[model samples]
Target: MDVRLGHGGSMFFVRDALRKLTLLSLLFGMAFRAAALVPENVVVLYNSSDPESEEIAQYYRQARGIPEGNLVGLALSQKPQISRDEYNRTIRDPLRKIYEDRQWWELGKNQSGQTLPFVNRRPVLAIIRGVPLKIGGSPLPADFKSDPDDPISKRNEAAVDSELLLLGGLDAPIQGVAPNFYFEGEKRFEDSKLSFMLLISRIDAATVATCKRMIRDAIQIEKTGLWGRAYIDYSNRHQMGTSWLNSIQNECRAQGFATVADRFNQSFPRNYPLSDAALYYGWYDSSVSGPFLNPQFRLRPGSVAIHIHSYSAAQLRDASRNWSAPLLEKGAAATVGNVNEPFLQLTHRLDILNDRLMRGWTWAEASCAALPVSSWQSVALGDPLYRPFHHLDGSGEEIERDRDFRSLVKLARKNSDPGQRLKAIETLAAKQKSGILSEAAGLEALAQGKRGEAQKWFKAALVEYQSADNQIRQYLHLAAIARHAKQTKNAAGILKSGLSRAQSFPNSAALAEWLQIVEPKPKPKPKATSGS
Candidate 1:
């Protein structure tokens, strides 16, 4: 039967006047169907680097329904798993075609290029937790501070920009470079972008706001298959209430599909955390947008597992840390955080095996342990704990106490007993009288270059310094460390401010050293553009 009035098999998706109306008409031919059993075939992803990788490999076989064989190889000849294109093509593609032929709407792929299972089936989640791999195939850019442009961060930024463009401008199929997960969906490639053409039904979870595409549901993914990534899903399907997705309503901008989208009568805004970029093609039914910075990974329907990496309300970290969460959750099977290369290494390995351990059509699996090797090295995670303002000379190395703290972290991984590790952390922590463990942790974190560690310690230390010996020295210590932290304006003001408070205190040497530290690090001039 002809589903639309204008043409054969096609429907209008966007328009200008009714832009405020929640988008409708995506279900021109999509009929709501009951869910079924899990799909056959699966894709495995990895984010591991140790014995646990093999252990996860074993667990998927025994605990999860996957058989001992059928696991394909990734990361050939390289230390880290580089790409998984071959495995997806051979394994996941055939399975997706099965569902597409069946027209499973709920668990099926959406118009905006999102993957959801038939409305009622147990979705196959490709776990990628313990498979550890190197961060990127290419060397990091120079001037790349560890926190700025790492693999996950760069990808996240790419996603934000992609969603912005895709809401009304998803011309390129794939937006940025990403893990190739889509095996069988209609592959659309333009200017190096890739996209999987899928159909999105008009209805979605009540919690998903109206307007725009990118509707998804949060599912609690377990690792009954062992050492795979464990994720907490909060998409349009469920009301996790962790965070709010942004929604912007921009009327008919510039996507070539503007005419095609006129059927829905709603113009999507270019908002991140609000919509997915692939929706401009008019397939997604949900309102949330996707971060499509990388190349569009056009996976076929009913292929391997599909997981969306949205957060619950009040669960986001500071700008740097939280940005990488979605990438790891969706891409890697297992991941970890560290003073260096936190998310990619561990999760990469886990996801690989999770993908490998798929059964042709299996029952549901449970979540895995958060980590096989819980915390690795003892790295103070906050500002006050790591970056303490010691009155040491320029030659100062890390304090011995800090060294012991690191040892305890390593022991957490090695120690079999959870009670013992907790005891050890307590024993080390007992040495400090800084009220809460957070103060010492703040100083230690600062030493490691985390953003807020110093400020936390300063607030704590300020209270104690009224009684400490040589109050001026303590004040100078805070000011000096602030300089290295790149708070030039704050450091200068703090130094000048400290003088007023320390008028009668002895030992002005600390004050002089602080003055020296603040003298450098001037702001650079902006580069001239060609037009200017």
Candidate 2:
């Protein structure tokens, strides 16, 4: 009787243990599913190298309904100085500036006497780089003059200190702008573009990285810098109307800085564009603190800051005088009251932000001059689907991959003719040797929110034909363009249309890839609504 009782008790304990294990398994499965849905935020660094950047930003912004504040703009000076080969050592000349008689900072500190609540609200930071050469009409401070033998050692110290402050080394992102490009213009030179290239060549990647870090760390907001990267440099001035001006308005609006757009267009009363730069204009005459606050519409002539990108002397004078420049263009001069002059003028300035500005001469520049280093970047706008590298690996395989992609990219970029670019891509598609499969998937992902499935298909396709990189690249370009219109099905169709040709000539090496993207059964579909 005792042995039977013991056996029955042991069986009961075993049954209880199994039930607990099942419950634990169910809980863990739920947690894993939840983890998969975790969302992430992406901050795009952009500047107007092409129209697509802004359009891409806007399309995403509107499509996703991200708050205006989420899509921010960063400021940079893009002035050309000189062009040099990649290997040649280059020297960056020191920019000089001396404001006469006017204590601009003091006036700015206490201007309008009304209010600057907004300025205090937002953070300000600075970024400084390059070796210092001199300081204010005197020897540099003694504290930093490590080289006693150098005659200008004292001068260099003060300059160094100023540069450090400008770079916001202390992490106080209160105000950061390049004194050279911010106050003056780019230096006058024989060939502006060539000069700019030379200057940029002198700037080491370390200095750029330092500046980028400063900007990112200084912003008080949770999000770091989301400024367009293209406009960050002082050499690409032509990209402005599309990148700079419009970004000013968009970022200002997003940051809760402005009420009226006119405040941005109007020139300040006393020729002070720098001091009066603000985020927004108030109900009557008040302005908020941010990028759009222009003390004077035009900057001082021949100054290092504006020298890179200032309008003509006559244009500057007109802007400084009282915002009286002819707002009309040759095509629209006939339309009088019908045309809103301030808006039109502002739009002209803002037009720099639009990619369409690159339509005529720019199309060629973008097509031919632009260089893509690898297969992933070979597409005109640079789709990273072809090459599987964010940074080059420098391996033998990587070198070969890089060279092959580079050739294809050069092939695409070498032609300014749109028809030729298409023809080249189509010809490769017929052979199916190498191409961009991920790009097609990216488009598909954008269209139907079936990102995983699209990714699977792209990976599978690439696995099937890594050798034919060109065909893959063309399909990727098509995907980027289609993402704007919310045509997921059409994007998918592009893949299907070219799939047969893409697979014909496959890579003998590389493994077969498999993936399927699916949404949660789409909530079992709703019942149909019928007419009553």
Candidate 3:
């Protein structure tokens, strides 16, 4: 009755099945573990003296489910910038007492059950909500002699969040001159150094509503995964600082991102076509008065943009000229800039920031890790909880839910073998699939001059896909095919249908603009004007 296979063959088949199952299980487990930068791991800090700050913090606490114990409100000045004296008296001293008295976190336990200094139960992120964004350092006494031996003595002012990176140091007159223990190569967070304890980020914008919008955007985009293109702007000067931007291009490629890099000597051009841009990293511009200020330069929702310029965040509420506010106003989900002159060596490193972000770290974690010195000049603006790559290594089941990820994976694998690519296309098409994979396959067919076959695949994409971006892509491609076939009316109709379907898509402006070019308005009848 069971003679289809010999004993040895049956055993072999069973063993092979078990091995594949085990492998898949392991990969899925890894994906699950890498899926999130836990929201509960962040503590929200607010200024008790500022009603606006407290209100914002309360809203975030409820929205994010932060435990009551994690909410720390400090009484302090509401000024945008505070002097060293005010910082010590109103900020540092009180924060230290709260940490010690309230047992904000317990010391980490050693192997033998004794507690260790650096290791602790502290949350990884401290979000400063509603406090002054920057701090000014105290001047050395005039009679004090300059000491070449002590580098810490030469510092003048620092960012408040940067200074607080030394939360574990509780020692008097914390100099903030200590090295960033959590910088690139160091063990992150759990290491017991005072300087490496808590990473700080901020949520701020031109107003409270703007701040809330930024937070909601970060959460929404991370869930769906960021899509579209990346724009990298490199300065022509070849200065050491500007040259680092080149690394972003390489990293974006490795992350399987579509990118447009501008290495031109000039700033971002006034009429640069910045369509579908999801990421932007540029520098050397002193103000936010560049081509990006154009009304049409709206960044895709969930876009992360930053620039390298001293004092670019000097005033976040000044929406016209500062980097932070302008970027936020232009629809960027998150950004970072300096509150003062953070010299090249002290500024956050672009390469490191890019790497950490790609590795699934949240905006706060990446910014803090890349910062060479905090409490001096850097200000992270946006939701600290934003993690752009949280699902990069997610489970296959989760990957199936995202059409963009499927398309990227298909692109990466398509060139490895032509025969395999053909087989995959045929197999996917036979199943009546509608997804980015199908859309990409159709595009490949079109590239090979099989226009009719490509049109079929695109048509399937419009019916079967669920992602708004992929649906728009299918519409655009279908419209292009119609235009190539000399059917101008058909092309215009396709675009109009897409706009009707995806009315609120962030990049729909491109479709609307294209329609104007292809189908201009008809002039009014001469008889109507004359009333004849």
Candidate 4:
């Protein structure tokens, strides 16, 4: 009766993997087109009032080689949130004046020697460094007519980063969230009907140190490439949000990236091992508490993780609290969080975010592409120009170079037939001796109820893994295999070992939580009554 070795459960999952791979192959045929704006087209905006903000701006400019003329200093509040009136005066008016002065971009000349119109020369990207996160909504306009049937229609508030996209139209009385002109299926920036579509993002977090590191991480990863797995977790609250995550996971697969998507209503698993995560999108949680708390867990450089709970950005100074700072402290290069309870609908669109990045949009562009509101609740933190997949042309050739990618391909094909699946497992084992591939083989073995084979593959994956940062996920996976073998004590021991190793690592929040899950105290057996 020990379903621990249940054939039905294991075999069903094998068929599921094959079906997913077939669907993934079909969707992989979508065309990839490049975006219009490049790094040189961006203008960096920094607060002149805050010394740390100014320093971060200078550091970014120097590191990115952004033109000195492209740097724009603004006198604004050091506070994280500002009023609409103050924002209008300090941000809108000043930026409008600067654009009118034609200082942000170089002027083009006509054949007749006349200067080209300002519309032709506006910067497409606005890199707002160290700006306030949110702007309090202004009172409804006198002519503001709201449909009594729709409560969301009266949304007059905005995230500061989101509002800046409409800097040119700030004078107009805006309603709720501004529509994203660069949304998916729309023309790229150059071909769009709109004269301007400025993509805005910020380099900000708890301190200037975190901001500086974010910029550095972005720079490093763009060059080396964001090589790793993709994890998408959704609480399945809003169908729209869940759909976005679903699309992202598919796109990741098309690009030959390994992905694990959780469609459950539960939080991310406490002991869920995440390895070499290049991109992660999960939400509906309020704070930095979950499987992510495993101290051994850290996102790879240039990884962008967004948690869509209201007030997740309320506090960024402490890594223990809000999502943004902890993610940064845990090694994510960039993150977006809500300073206030920005409604679920207003959160960043995962599809748009993923699509833009695939199209060579920079970190700033991709981060802001799906945001529906400005001067409201959300704030983005990281280098504005970090483009993780900028070099990947979606040809799959570049992805094929990574051993893990090759292994994933083999593993995905391991569900065709008994013979074919066996061949795939053998081919993967022969091609590379990597931890990732071994772990994949181990998972496949466990799924087939081959406990001995699973143990061999998992142990092989875990051996000689010196750094906890790189092997935490492997440990967790191995522990999972142990659980399948009815070896709870062994799984607990593996988690404890990972916890010890993670002490010296950057972020180990997930490890301790994982240990708790694997080693939960045994419940006492019920005592029988004397003679019931």
Best candidate per lDDT, number? Answer: 3
Model 1 / residue 76 / CA error / Å: 9.8
lDDT of 4 by residue, 157-188 (tens): 66676777656432334454444445443445
lDDT of 3 by residue, 1-532 (tens): 1112223344343334334433422221111111123556566888998888888888877777777777878888888888887887887778666666766544443344433233333444445556877777666766766555333345667777777765654332334243454567333333323322576778888888877777777877777667656677776544555556767766665554545455545555443446567788887677885447667668877788887787778888867886878888888888888777665555788888888887777777788788765446677777777887666554223433355544554543453453355446646655756464566567556645678878888888778777675677677778778867878899899989988988686556556755765797887777735545
* Candidate lDDT (C-alpha), each: 0.27, 0.23, 0.65, 0.64
Model 1 misplacement above 4 A: 1-56, 59-92, 97-122, 127-517, 521-532
Error of 4 at 238 (Å): 4.2
* Candidate 3 CA-lDDT value: 0.65
Candidate 2 per-residue lDDT, tens place, 1-532, comes to 0112123344343234334332322221111100010001212222233233344444433433344443333222222211211001221111111011211011111132321111111011111222211121323233542433322112211222123212211111111111111111121211111111101100101223322322222121111111110111112223332244445444322221111122222222221112111111111112122111223232111001111111111121122221111111100000001011111111122222122212211111221122111000011111101111111112222233234333334443453453454345434433553333233233223233454444554544455553453344334434424433466566555544444455553310110110001111245777899999
Question: How do the residues 151-249 of candidate 1 rate in per-residue lDDT, one tens digit apiece?
Answer: 232221121111111111112222112221212112211111212211111111111121001111111112111111111122233221112111100
The window of 10 residues in a row where model 2 has the poorest summed lDDT is 330-339
After best superposition, candidate 3 residue 274: deviation in angstroms? Answer: 1.9
Error of 4 at 334 (Å): 1.8
- Model 4: weakest 10-residue lDDT segment is 24-33
Give the TM-scores of the predictions, in the order they appear. 0.26, 0.22, 0.67, 0.73
- Among all candidates shown, the one with the greatest TM-score: 4
lDDT, model 3, position 257 = 54
